[model samples]
Target: MSASKIAIGCMHLLAKLPLPLLRGLGKVVGRVLFVVAGQRRRIALRNFELCFPDVPEVQRKAWAKESFEVFCQTFLDRSWLWFGSEELVRSRVKLVGATHELKGDTPTIVFAPHFYSMDAGGLALPLNTEREFTSIFATNPDPDLDRWFMNGRQRFGNVKMLNRADGVKPIIQCLRKGGLLYLLPDMDYGKNDSVFVPFFAVQDTATIPSLSRFARLGKAKVVALYNRMTPEGYVAELTPAWENFPTDDHVADTARMNRELQAAIMTMVPQYYWVHKRFKTRPDGEPSLYSGK
Candidate 1:
């Protein structure tokens, strides 16, 4: 069997294990990764340093280590979330706060950031409501892994997974028809069609302005869904739709989005996806953040 198939089979077997035991194993694996995954460890540390410069290095390192643990636990959680019994999933993943916003859609866009428990948050929507849901994702290179992700995400309610290459017309159509759009536009997706905005301490962070653009085009109200992983399972909290969003200026709207995201990330610093190169694409003539090692 191919490596991906073997991995999938192992995860399928893992689904039968109790949540506590599976999480314990994930903790062990995360510690090992912290010791051996030098490049990723450095990246996480660098991101912490850039974002939380005022904070002491020792404390920042602690958060980075805990981030690894959370990341691993959330990754292993997919086994049960995707393949386990519905009774188990429904019991664990809790949806809280402003859930009424999801009712009657009225063209809503869910601003889901790259929290460790994001997949859990993704499941929260379809599992709860019967509304038509749509999300855009980049196709994974490995076909087996790609299939795994697509199947896991679409396993719930009426969900349509659109490739990033697929243009915005269909997305807008769904939104206008009172469908939910789960958007994760926080990462650094290169300089193309992105604007330099203030993200925490970083002044010229390369952030895609899609959140603002989509809200404008689709005429949708933006709601933020922040997910956190607890001992029992995950909590997907949906904030009420933002008022006066997507104003005349798209750039200003994007900046406001970052500000809101920053506030949410502060509540659970270690749970955020810090390993990504958030400051990768710099303005004209700026040095690379992760140049050496």
Candidate 2:
């Protein structure tokens, strides 16, 4: 068997384990990775340093360690989240808060950040409501891995996964048809087609202005879904739709998006995706934040 298939089979077997045991395994694995995964550990630390400079070093380190633990725990959670029974998944992942925002076909966009429990949040929507859902994904290099991800994510409800290269026409169409667009536009995708905006303490962070663009193109109301991981499972909370989003100025709209994201990130500091080199793309004549780590 191919390595990816074997790995997937192992995960399926892992699905048979109890949640507590699976979480324990994740904690152990996370601890080991924190010690051995030098590059990733450094990236997480650097991100924390940049985002939480005012916080004490010891506290930041503690949060960093816990972030790693939560990351692993969420990764392992995919085993049950994907292959486990629907009853199990329903019992575990709870969809709450402003859920009425998801009701009716008003063309909605879910501003889902890169929290560790994002996949759980994605599943929560389809599990709770019968609305057609769409989300963009960059295809994995490994075909088997890509297939695994596609199948796992589409396991419940009617979900259409769009390739990032597929452009915005279909995304807008889906939104106009009242389908939910789960967007994670908070990451630094690169300077191309990105606007420099304030993110936390960083002044000129590269952020995709797609949220505002899509909202305007699709005439969609933007709602923020912040997912949190708990011992029981995950809670996907939906905020009320923004009142005056997607103004004429895309840059201003994008900046407001970051400010809202910063507020959400503060609620669960360790649960956010900290290992990514968020400040990798710098403005002209600026040195890389992740250099010489």
Residue lDDT tens for model 2, 92-158: 9999999999889899999999999999998999998899999999999999999999999999999
Candidate lDDT (C-alpha), each: 0.94, 0.94
What TM-score does structure 1 among the candidates reach?
0.99
Report the C-alpha lDDT of model 1 over 126-192, residue by residue, as the tens digit.
9999999999999999999999999999999999998889888889999999999999999999999
Q: In candidate 1, which residue ranges exceed 4 Å CA deviation? A: none
- Candidate 1, 191: how far from true, in Å? 0.4
RMSD per prediction, one decimal? 0.8, 0.8
Please state the error at residue 34 of candidate 2 in Å.
Answer: 0.4
**What is the alpha-carbon lDDT for the whole of candidate 2?**
0.94
RMSD of 1: 0.8
TM-score of 2: 0.98
